[model samples]
Target: MKMSDVAKLANVSPATVSRVLSNPDLVSKETREKVMEVINKVNYKPHIVARQFRTKETKIILVVVPDITSAFFSRVLRGIEHVAVKNGYQVILGDTENDTDRELEYINLLLQKQADGMVLLTARQDKEKLEEIAEHFPMVLACEYMDGSNVPTVSIDNISSARKVTEHLIQQGHTKIAHITGPINVVLGRDRLRGFQQAMMSHDLEIDSAYIQEGDFTFESGYNQMLKLLALEAPPTAVFAFNDEMGMGAIKAVKDSNLLVPNDVAIVGFDNIKMASVIEPNLTTIDQPKYEIGKKAMELLLNLINGEALQKKRFVMKDELIVRESSELVKNMP
Candidate 1:
């Protein structure tokens, strides 16, 4: 039913009904109770579209992810949505497909008042443009961070996590460990690569140039890089992939070459995605708390949107190592 009908039935003007709906405290206690009763009786619904137009606040938060198809990102999205819905806010998702131009375009949409704030999964973007957008908007970085910027970010310690993974390989008596990673432009990729290098250097292992390969964090890239590594004169006895997809690809490559995992060449991957457990060999990788990261990022963004003082500029989540059949140490020597 219309607000006019409710107003007439409640013995109040339309303006009074509107005020009660928007801010009940502004109306008298008796009048507010009466209006609410009428509203309940009629099951009256206010025109949120018009109200949003008038207030210029849509109460919507936009989440821009680099690859929405990744199980890793899906979990993160769920975390953000859960906290957002609990706080009486709506979330809109945008997948940029790792395209810098598209990412920038999505960020530009915020300027048109389509969304009140943004949660970005970092991709390659113009730093100056991002800083410009952040000046007037509430934004949080999830699963990635930008160096030399004060942007609020929630992510795991990639360097330490990668080092741990490398250390595990070392403990397995695998001295010739190879590393595959994503593009160096992204923070996570660079940090993980650095972690791998640091761990090798600390152990006095030569950081062989030929043992490192770069991928685009894609399954195909992983497969291709693994093939290239396998073609080397002395293939690594163990391989470390930056993410789960690449690690899976590496597994496929190894199988195609008629080699056994952990026996001929052990493999470890990052991002303990759900499929990691169900896969044939089961993946050994770093377990990042994707859902918690998303939840915490949204909570921080909501607080910032509410003009609350933020005690910290950045937040780092911890990572865990899950050993599986894929990276089991070689037992018997031929």
Candidate 2:
């Protein structure tokens, strides 16, 4: 159906209908609702390419994620999709596949005016580069963020969440704790590591240098790191991993070595992925608002795109610590 037909049926001018469809905020609230009702009733679809030629907007959003296979990013993507669809927009998935070059290629799409806006799930770009991009396009960061840039971000307090989980293990009287970290180059890895370290120091616990293992946020890396830590003269009584994938890997390694969970060695993880709750012994992990972060990031980006001012650029979400059998001692059972 044509937009003119929609305008006639809705009792508004074609220009008003165009404004309602392309940028709802520009129209009056009553007019927007009436136009949308007519739109839904007629199922009229605009020719996006023609619209783009006239408005310089594709009505498509570019969502860039570092890894496609990771469940953590997938959850965030779901949230982003929900908001995009409701706002008459399409989302293009840009999987970086952990390659910086590939990531930059997706960003360049924005520079080329293929996408109206962008939501960066993983912020690996240099501060200057990200600033340059944000200056020219509407952008928001999710999960990961820039170090000192003004780019809006939606994420939890990684350090506090990590420290709180570590403190849980310490409160249970487990010392000699080992840490399995994400790649130290990123903020997620660095903040989680600092949280673990700070928690250990707060309790006057001996921070074992040999117990720190760096993982690439993968199961294999977690398994391998756990093996290395197990080989130490005195292995840790508990292990904290930056993510659930690594935590599960550590559990497998411990079981392989004939060690009991929470008895021989307790395990804790961040990011309460689905597997975290389904494992043999449910994982004790931090529940980050992955879905909410994605939803908010898109909202912020849309506001920027619609020329609305954002009162707050940075949104720090809250996290909950879930305790389960993975980190619970049988003796301490109620």
Candidate 3:
């Protein structure tokens, strides 16, 4: 049934029906209930497809992630899907796979009115381009943030989370701790690296340049970076990978080298992904509320879509460290 039919049944103008749908709070409780009762009795469903032709809104939110294979993104996607489905909206996924050109293409699609809003997982795009796009549509930055801009974002305090992981390693008496990180250009990568540095400096320990290696937040990159560290003349006693994928990779690399984990070398990782606990040496890492981050971002986007005023621009989630066998060297002793 059309909204006009519902409006006629409820004896109200179609504008009132539109207001009730967009912002029920703007209408009185009695009017809102009366409209909803008629909506339910008639089972009226607006033709969103036709509405899009006139209003330029498809009621679809595009979620862009660097990679879909990573379990971290999977949880985040779940959160977004949960909220989107609840609010009578649809979500579309765009996997950029760390390709800047692909990212730009997806953004261009959104700009062309194929989608109503976007949630970006990377910060590699041009700042000016993003600012220009923000003028016309609502956008939320998830898992990463733009440099030198106040974009509405949903993410954990990466710097603090990374510092906590580093401190955990230090407290275990690992002076020569190594770091395996994602691309340095990404905000999370840089913040995590800075946290590692800050933790080392706080203890009056020199941040050894040799112990630092860069990865692309992939398992293979983690494995190769670990190999490089192990080949060094004086390999570090402990290692910290930015994510669980790399952390698992580090464990596999150490195992292949015939080294005993936590005994010969300790390892820690971030993002308590599902596989973290399943691995032989359970990983000690920071637990980011990945699903909650996704859910909150969608909820905020819905509020914006409904014309609700936002009290804050950024939503910062909390992170926790889950200590397991991987980083617990002494605790693992026989």
> Global lDDT of each model?
0.89, 0.91, 0.89
Can you list the residue pairs that collide in candidate 1?
Answer: none
**Any runs in candidate 3 off by more than 4 Å, and if so which?**
1-48, 331-334
Order the candidates by TM-score, highest first.
Answer: 1, 2, 3
Instruction: Report the C-alpha lDDT of model 1 over 54-152, residue by residue, as the tens digit.
Output: 888788999998888887898899999999999878999998888888888888888887888999987467666677777678888889888766778
C-alpha lDDT (0 to 100) for residue 109 of candidate 1: 82
Kindly list the per-residue Cα lDDT of model 3 for residues 1-334, writing each as its tens digit. Answer: 8888889999999989988987888999999999999998988887777788868788899999998888999999999999998876799999999898999999998889788788888768888888778667777888888756666789998998999999999999888899998899888899999999999999998788989999999999999999999999989989999899999999999999999788888999999999999998999999999999999988877776677777987888999999999877565332
lDDT for each residue of candidate 2 in 79-192, tens digit (9 for 90 to 100): 999999999889999999888889899999999999999999888888898888897799999999876678898999898999999999988878788999999998899999
Greater-TM-score candidate between 1 and 3: 1
Residue-level error in angstroms, candidate 2, position 127: 0.3
How does candidate 1 score on lDDT?
0.89
- For candidate 1, the per-residue lDDT at 79 reads 96
| Reference-based TM-score of each model | 0.92, 0.88, 0.86
Error of 3 at 159 (Å): 0.9
RMSD of each: 2.2, 3.8, 3.8
